[model samples]
Target: MKLYIAEKPSLARAIADALPKPHKKQDGYIEVAGGDIVSWCIGHLLEQAEPDSYHDRYKKWNAADLPIVPETWQLKAKTQTRKQLTILKKLIKQADELVNAGDPDREGQLLVDEVIDHAKPTKVKKQNAKRLLVSDLNVGAVKKSLSNLKPNSEFIPLSVSALARARADWLYGMNLTRAYTLAGQKVGFKGVLSVGRVQTPILGLVVRRDLEILNFVPHAFYEVLAHLNPNLDQDINSQTSETFTAKWQPSGACEPYMDDEGRVLHKGLAQNVVSRINDQVGTVLSVDKKQKKQNSPLPYNLSSLQIDAAKAFGMAAKQVLDTCQNLYERHKLITYPRSDNRYLPKDHHKEASQVLAAIKNNQGQEASKVDGANTRLKSKCWNDKKVEAHHGIIPTVKKLQSASLTKDEKCIYQLISRHYLAQFYPEYIYNETQVEIEIAKGKFKTKAKQEVNLGFKVLMGKSELDSEEKLPALIKGQKLLCFKGELIEKQTQPPAHFTDATLLAAMTGIARFVKDPEIKKVLKETDGLGTEATRAGIIELLFKRGFLKRQGKQILATESGIALIQVLPEQVSKPDLTAVWESSLSSIAQKELSYQHFMQPLLQQLSDIIELSKTCDSSAFKSLPEQKPNKKFRRKRKTYKKAS
Candidate 1:
């Protein structure tokens, strides 16, 4: 008998539907004709045992119990999924061959692989196991995946990488959470101070931004614009007259009067420049014109999609992820929703016609945008080498059931479809013109960008179209008249508070925030702070823990959040550690680093952190409001009387 273990029930059903069937649904699995069976794990059937499970003394949070390192890590069946685990165990023993049919990512690899380990199938059966990677739930996609099953052993590095991440997180989060919570208790704070590998760094980002905003000092800056006309003799109101504005560029001699950013700090300097250029004749020093083409934005990766949804609809990251999951799993309308890669497999280009047809038929008014899409046009997004474990989230060829979708779902679906359709459209083309003018020994310049071809922008709506500015044809050394000069005053503004969109963007592009060049380089090459699947949940966890709150659409760190960051060590609060770990984790996935080599240093680091945490000041936590205890219902322990 062949046994297929899937990540979830929906996937199991999808796999079953693609097989030769006369299917019989059992309590926990489905039996197919030809003695094949398919079963599923409810997310993860097992999880890392709690610290208490390792030892009785570790049950309560204690300072002495710092750095609780497990000598031999153990996995215990999750209480809710114990029954499903039992059914899988029995099936594994009866099966002649096995297949690991999890989502094609690190976590998915570990979740199902751990179950097979827990079931303890015969060594021969285990070694002979195959892997089925399915990113789409559609029957056709699943059938294609079935024919391409590879040896499960080939992905052992991926499983190890996932295991290392899980254990590292456990070691880091569990120890730090306990160590910090105990320290907070010492300072009369009532809340359980939680610190995580990813969550703490996220909190640090917000707290730092908030402090920067609070301490910001606005400064005034001045600019001089030369209003010029190509024909000074022509009437100003005449349609034949061509006029434009150019900004004054300060010379090196004026450095003392300017700020570091090239903004003129002294209003007198700007006024003098305005007076010098007004109603004067200026010579055009340079005239450069070029046509540029911009390709449409690539297809939706989870982070990009989340950022856009947050911007357009003010939806939270979790809300967008949930909607995407529904679209991918239940509706089967799109591909995998947790991909970090924005590039699609080149082979997917073959299905462009069918995907385009589905978009045209399903989208109502938006369907019209698909009419001009040329399926023959291939965008840079179709790169086989750039495609990762999963391709970009795109609409499948399945017909849409628009009436069944919610308002948000419809919005999200349209976004994914639009991006995919945009791949087939022509590049947006424009003419960029730069003119440099010299007047009274001062330089003034202006740039004009006029649309040459709307291309994909036609489908993207008016907001995406560039505002056109026309410049009259001119040659270098050509004379023009400056009608008047205008002095503009501006103030430098503080950085904006993080919203759902900006926060997700920060998390994905965290390299921008790091100071160390080496770590920054590594972070740039890696998926940022958290994976696409966990970033939303991490943000939500902060809110649930009272560490973060929202003001309208802005995400702000609460007092408790700020205090926790203040009390923790710098390494514990910054993204540097995550960057280093991700670098090592990637190496582990590529077989360049061993799990032991990664964990040993981490264990030592945890010890050092716990040791340092003991000495840090807890005063910041003392000022925080006491956290109220959650009222949770506990089940009564039933007692049985012994019979004589």
Candidate 2:
């Protein structure tokens, strides 16, 4: 009998629908015609065994057991899903052929492969297993995937990479967490000082940012503006009187009075410029005009979608991920929600008509915008080569069931649909004009953008519109009169606290925060702090651990969090180490690096970190508040009133 093991129950049903008809659903497996069966795992059926699993002595936290590294890694079935695991084992033994149908990503590949390994299938059956990659759950997409299966062995490296990551995190987290917790306890702080490869660095980022904000000192700065009018015939007053304001561009001679960022540091310098240029005749030095076109934004990747949702609706990252999952799994209104790629497969262009129609039917008030989209127009988002393990999140061809969606689901679905629809719209066109004028031997510059065509901006709403001033017509060497000069004083402000949108943006583009060029380049090429499937969860975990708290919409580190970061070694508190590990993992996935090659150095580093944790100064943790023990709530029983 042929057997198919899917990643989850919904996926199993989708796969069954695409196979031969006459399906019989059983308690844990689905039987199809022609003696084929399909089964699924509930997410991950197994997880890495905890430290205590290796030895009973390790169960209690102690500094002596620091740097606990397992000689050989082991997997243990989760208690909640043992029944399903048993059913899969029996089915694997009975099947003549097997297919691994997991999601198209590293974690997905590892979860199903690990299950097959634990089941101990026949050598030939395991070696000859087929792989199915499905990003969309619709019947048509699943059918296409069924016709194009590859050998599952080809993805062993991907699975190995995931395994290496899990083991590495286990070793690092267990050893360091125990080591630090012991240290904190010595300092009279009782909380569990948990540390992780990714979560620790994230906490460090917040703690450092909060410190910077607290230490910042605001100072005053000065600026000069010139209001000029066009003198077409070299006349002081012309019949055509249109005036424009230009900002002062300090000359090289003004360096002594400016800051590194070119902001005027002295009030007297700015006042002098204003005094010299006020009510003086000036000459237009240069006028540059160019027409430009801006293509519509690509479809939604999980990070970009989360960022936008946070900006537009004040939604948290976890909330957005949950809503997207509901839309993808329960409603089947959209494709994969955990995609990191923003480009679509070129073949998807063929289904534009159906997707647009579905959007029109689903969208209530925004239906009119769909009519204006030209289906023939193709944007740069349709690039087959740029498509990664999963394509961008988009609306499926299936018509939306509006009544089944929640308010959050509706908002997210509309967002995905609009981005998809924008692909068929024309590019936004505009004319950019810049004018450079010379007044009293000082330079002044002004820029303006005029919209030639609204194009995709119409669907994007008013946020994308360019609200810059539109410059009047001017020519080089043409005369102009400076009506007046204004001196403006402003204060230099410290950076704003991290918000949901900005924090996600920072994590997605973490390279900007790195100082080392090589590490920065690597982080730029790979996903930043964590994978798309895990970033939201990682952030939420910090909140649950009390390392992060929310003040209004801003995310801040708690006192305990700050104390932990201050006590930890610099290497553990920075993103540089994680960035390097991410690059190595990507190499392992591509078969360019071996699992041992990545883990060997990590093991050594883990030992060094554990040793440091044992002796690090714990003074910072002394002031931390006492840890509160968890209180379990119990229900009260009601007494009968009949006696009264």
Candidate 3:
């Protein structure tokens, strides 16, 4: 008997249908012919042990328990998923053949292998793999993948990296949160006080901007404009003339910036230029045409997909991940959703068309869902060479199980469908135009763009296209109308509040505002800010702790948040640390550096940062606007006295 495991039950069922003599059981799993047995776990059935789980005495929170950093982390079956573990265990023990069939990524590998650890499989086990790594849950793809499973050892490095990430997050989050909460409580605040490695730096960004706004003062500036009536025949070079014609040439255009406070900071005498023209003839400099092709974007990886989905359909990041997971595991319409790589191996290109053809046949499915109409194309996001550790998010050509879809699932499906079809659709082609004008001593210019061809427009089948802004051409100096645009001074805006989108952007890279160019260049190898998987949790930690506040879509840092960075004796909130750590991790991944070599400095820095920040003065940070200094918050009383 062979035991097979899958990421989810829906997927297990799909695999079971392909095998012979399948028997489905409620608590257990489906049994197929030839004495083969298959089972599944829903996501992570086993997890790293919690601090409270370490001992009965540590079950509750207390101030004395400042940092619950564990030396030897253990594993346990999660309470929510123990039953599935039991089923898998029972099958693994009796079966003669074993297979690791989890989702095909770090998280997926963790889910399956950890369960195996729980089951206590025998050594020297000859396991056959059910490598069903397709985006769609179709029968053909699933069956093909099962027959080609590789040995488990091949994925050891991936599992190692995943586990390391998990451990690091746990260590950083637990210890920091405990320390911060205790520290805050000592100062009369009674909040849970949370902290995360990724989140604190992120919160710092918001806090800094808020301070700039609070400290800002506004100012104004003045300038003049003239409506020009030029001659059409002779070429009048405005660049050579000395007058303020550039500012007056346009009907609509933007001037320039402001200083610290929302004020127009201007310096030096105003500059201007003028040109002599008969206002009769304007000669066309040149009308140039060039053919340009825009290739379809590479397939949807985790972050890119999330951003695009959010922009196009207003979906949340977490929501997009969940839907993509379901589509991959249940419907089997797509590949892995948690991947970061957008490129594929050269080998994958050969069979790419099968996916394309499937979507084309299911036009209604390969296209996005339309309102008030049943006839439409289906959705798919696929690329062969463009895929990395996993292929792009694409729908499998399999006929969808429409009944099983929830409302959210349908929306996700629509998002995936549109992206997939767009790949095979044609390259977007357009004609671009550039124009230059010189007026006044200062040069003023305007540009106009015209669309000649939209190649992939046919794939959308006359669907609504993105909007464009362009104006009819004005050949060289052919001035028909005279419109003098006045110089309206614009005050500079304080840095914008961090929205979820902007926060994510800032979190994605470790690039800095540092003065040194060399230091900035080194961060290129480092994953920006944080990976997609960890960024949300980091932000959540900030909110859970009083360090950050959520006001509708905007993220504001709390007083504590500002103070933490201000008093931090060193740059704990700086991206420099992230960059250094990233460079080390890249070295580790390439076998060029060992873990000890990488972590020793980190541990030292951690100690230095914690000690330095704990003892430093926070005067500058405390004065920030976010704290609303002098305003008091009433302390909440957790303990009540009755009938005194």
Candidate 4:
């Protein structure tokens, strides 16, 4: 019998449905019609061994033995998942061949491969392992994918890269966390100073934002506006000849009026400029008309989906991921959701019409609005060169009703479906008009935009359509009336606190924070800070560990969080080290570099960080209070008085 293992039960069940007839169900696996057995893994069945797993001596955290680097890595099966492992091991012993049917990514390849390695069956060995990669879990797709299984060795580099990443994380997280926590212990700070490759850099983002918000000083700025009425031709309608407002623009020698921050700092000068331009008839110096087109956005990658979902429905990043996963796995309504690539393989274009037809048949009124995208429209989203392991999240050919989905599921599904449908729609077209007027040697400007077509905006719903700001027809020499100029006083705001949307943005493009150009370039070339699948969890970890908290939607660093950054060296908190390591991981994946090459420098850096921790002072965290004692005390004299 051949054993086929999947990443999740839903995917396994779907594959089973595609196989030939007569199948028997067991406790942990299904004997398929094709003399093969299908089983499933609940994500990762094995994890990296903890520090205590290396040796008993490492159980206790000590400053002397700070950098704990294991010579050979160890793997331990998750206790909760041991029963499934037992089932897999039994099947492995009975089978002559095995198939690795995990998700089509680095982590997925490693997840199932590690489990098989743990079982250590002599007959069912890695030499005979086959890989089954399928983007969709539908019956036809599964059957086609199974017929074309390749040797698992083809993906060795990906697996090695993932292992390198996991080990590197363990080295940094374990050694650095122990080092800092021990350092803090000596200074009366009673908490685990948890650190991570991605987690610390992200924590630095919140801490820096908190500091900026705390130190910000409000400054007032002023702007001058004029209400102008232009002369209208007799042929024009009376309603179309209405007046409009224009802002006073600093010109010629008035450059000093604005400061470096783009604020008009001198309020008196603004008032004087306003007074000079007041009641002055200005000729329209120029009227510029330009037609512009905004193409539909590319489909939803996990990060963009998370950012958009957070904005639209106030869903947290993890919540969005969970919902999308549910739609992908349980509902089988969409393709893989954990993808970072937003572009589809060029060959996938053949299936576009079928997916559209499925949508047109299943979706009711919403489908009618998508008639524009129903045709064979070529899109930039279909570029094989740009696609990686998986494409953007898109609805599968499976037919499902919006009524069948939950509220959150419905919203997320709509978001995914609309983006796909938008690919076939024409670009949103509009004309922009800019009018510049001159009055008393000062210039005033006003701009207007008129929509030529709704295009893709129609699928986004009626409210999302752009509204036109009508401007009266004017000639270059036309003169207009100027009402009394008014000064609008406003205060400059500090950088807004990071919400889930903004924080994810920062985490995705962390190169913006790095000073080193080489590190910044590498971070951009590889995955920034964290994978899309892991970013939400990192932020959630910060919240769970009490290092960060939410004030409304804004993320704020806790006292413990701020103190942790304060005590650590800049190398630990900054993005450069982690980003450089991430670039090395990318190199391993590309076969451009080896694991030994990557780990050597990382291990050396870990040792250096440990050494740095020994000399680091933790007195900066003296003000941060630890958990207070819960026990309350009473005097014995009270009991004596009561007895008397």
Question: Residue 251 of model 2: what lDDT?
Answer: 83
Rank ordering of all candidates by lDDT, starting from the highest: 1, 2, 4, 3
Could you tell me the TM-score of candidate 4?
Answer: 0.90
Worst 10 residues of 3 by lDDT: 635-644
User: What is candidate 3's CA lDDT for residue 144?
Assistant: 72
TM-score of each: 0.96, 0.95, 0.75, 0.90
Q: Which lDDT tens digits does candidate 1 get at residues 110-197? A: 9999999998988999999999989888888899999999999999999999999999998998788778877877767665677788
Residue-wise C-alpha lDDT for candidate 4, range 412-488, written one tens digit per residue: 88888888888888888988899998878788899988878877887766733245456888879899877567888
Off by over 4 Å in 3: 24-26, 51-71, 118-123, 126-134, 212-292, 344-386, 400-410, 438-442, 457-486, 509-523, 536-552, 558-571, 575-593, 616-644
The residue-by-residue lDDT of candidate 2 on 267-362, one tens digit each, is: 999999999998888999999999999999999999999999999899999999999888877777889899989999999999998888988887
**Best candidate (score: lDDT):** 1
**lDDT scores for all predictions?**
0.87, 0.86, 0.57, 0.81
Candidate 1 local Cα displacement, residue 280, angstroms: 1.3
> Which candidate model has the greater lDDT, 3 or 4?
4
Error of 3 at 616 (Å): 4.6
Question: On lDDT, who's better, 2 or 3?
Answer: 2
